[model samples]
Target: MTKFFNSAMAALLISSTSIFAQVENDTEKPNSNPPISIETMAGSRGVMYQLIINKKFQSIPLGFFSVTNAAATWEKEMTPDIMTQAHLTYTLFKGLDISSGMQYTPVYGFRSVAGLIYSYVSPQMLIIVNPKVDLADDLAAESLALIEYRPKINDKLNFYSRLQGMYGFIPKSGIHNRSYIMLRAGLGYKEFAFGAASNIDWYGPIKHNENNFGVFVSALLF
Candidate 1:
């Protein structure tokens, strides 16, 4: 009777060990499914004010300007004459991006603007290309090219200067060209930034004006 009981106990122990080994093997199996990609949320808001004084020496009027989420899908603002813009972007390579968007401004007399922009950012320089077409009553088109050089100032402050030129073609009118030089200074703390840019518009003939200044403050949130 003792031998029979010992044999039964041995068989029970072997069965339990087999079951444990099978569970371990199942847990160690490699998963063949790929990991899911996650999307990140980022947003920015800026408020700008411009004072324009023309060469005719007229009264200076305050121009309120604002651009919110300038790079995202549903970006819009009201300060710059009640303008709204929608953008879609695709990354072509590292540090380079291409974006296309449509802008509408009711205050500007129901005008639609379609534009393509390319931006390149590096440690020492920044470049932007913007080509736009006006798809409204007046068939007008414009292109702006800008280049900025980054200057290292400090940990919280930085300085840069840019040169931009704009050319416009209007129906029944000849080509119009304008060039501007801008100086920008930025102060950053955490996710908030304050920046000011001074613009000097140089109009080629036709009595173009000059000495226009704009200041802006921006905040970024994650």
Candidate 2:
């Protein structure tokens, strides 16, 4: 076991160095086309795959693990000079998670729903405080909002700072129902990001706030 652990550590170190070097090189280039975006994260005893695809026909998006115990959604993006795509995610995990509006190009404008809009001036800073809304008879989470601040660290390196506040409310719950707040921040080069993510949920299924924090790396699978 010791030998295997040593080998794994060495391999991870080598891979990190390689990625850092490549990112530097890409930053030095004059201009590079925007890469496709697919977010994948692995850590905290679980893994998440958030692929970006959109279609008019209704069908489930498929990927690794090949099971429905996970969260998955597909989005459609088609641009006629200025293109905008939206995704609505409803699942068994967190009830309903609808992402904010984003702009893929500079030709059009950006829109947001629920809580407050982040920012219209900087285009990179967004702050929101959501109010609870009805999802169903038994399904609901205390109104929650998240602020995502993205900054370009370098030509090839981008840093993402995300903070979310959640107040869980189950109108049909029998007992303890707690609120949760999560912070996920990371740095990405090209289409990959690595960093620390933590989640704390109080008074829910376990009656106590569960704590989960760890290193996570996500890749663009699209």
Candidate 3:
């Protein structure tokens, strides 16, 4: 199990490096700007591992609740902006909020796993909800709520915390459905972040393979 997680983490790092290389830097030039961005997220639950790719487009704005349809209105209000996203999840076990599998096991498949995400991004906070349905033998409808907050601390460092949870409506299970909540809190230094991640699931308050406390790292690949 230790070897399995190590291999997964190594793969995540390798992919991150390649993505960082391919992505053109966005330094806020005086000319054209692209709204597309990519982010990398990886974590472990003892032996179970998860790697996620988060892609989002922010240029196309949804003026649903804004006073004006102008894209600049979001910049002024310091509130949420409407945007679309695609989330890809790969995991060794389905215990985390990201996967829809019913039990804890070694089998992990990416066959029919994908999510559609829409987000409202504000200056100090972000909210995202994803809708997903798997139609294969592993059937599930995964609904998720994700939130992030960054508080003012200093010039180079800030306090940050994120709450992400999901419920799996697997009527195929007949009775028990799957659900999990993952919370992470720590300090952010520029583009790099290290935080403590804690998660709970319906399988029990805690599982044997679950790590009570884990260190998680994330980076804006773009």
Model 3, runs deviating above 4 Å: 1-50, 56-115, 172-174, 204-211
Backbone N/Cα/C clashes per model: 0, 6, 0
Against the correct fold, how does model 1 do in TM-score? 0.45
lDDT, candidates in the order shown: 0.38, 0.39, 0.41
Ranking by lDDT: 3, 2, 1
Compose the digit string of candidate 3's lDDT tens values, residues 149-192: 77658888877787765554554653324455667788777665
In model 1, which runs have C-alpha deviations exceeding 4 angstroms? 1-85, 90-101, 105-108, 154-157, 175-181, 185-196, 201-210, 213-222
- Candidate achieving the largest TM-score: 3
| Top candidate (lDDT) | 3
lDDT of 3: 0.41
- lDDT (tens digit, per residue) of candidate 1 on 75-176: 354332232344444445532334444555442343556665544444445455556666777665655455545455788555544444444445445434
Q: Report the C-alpha displacement of residue 65, candidate 3, in angstroms.
A: 25
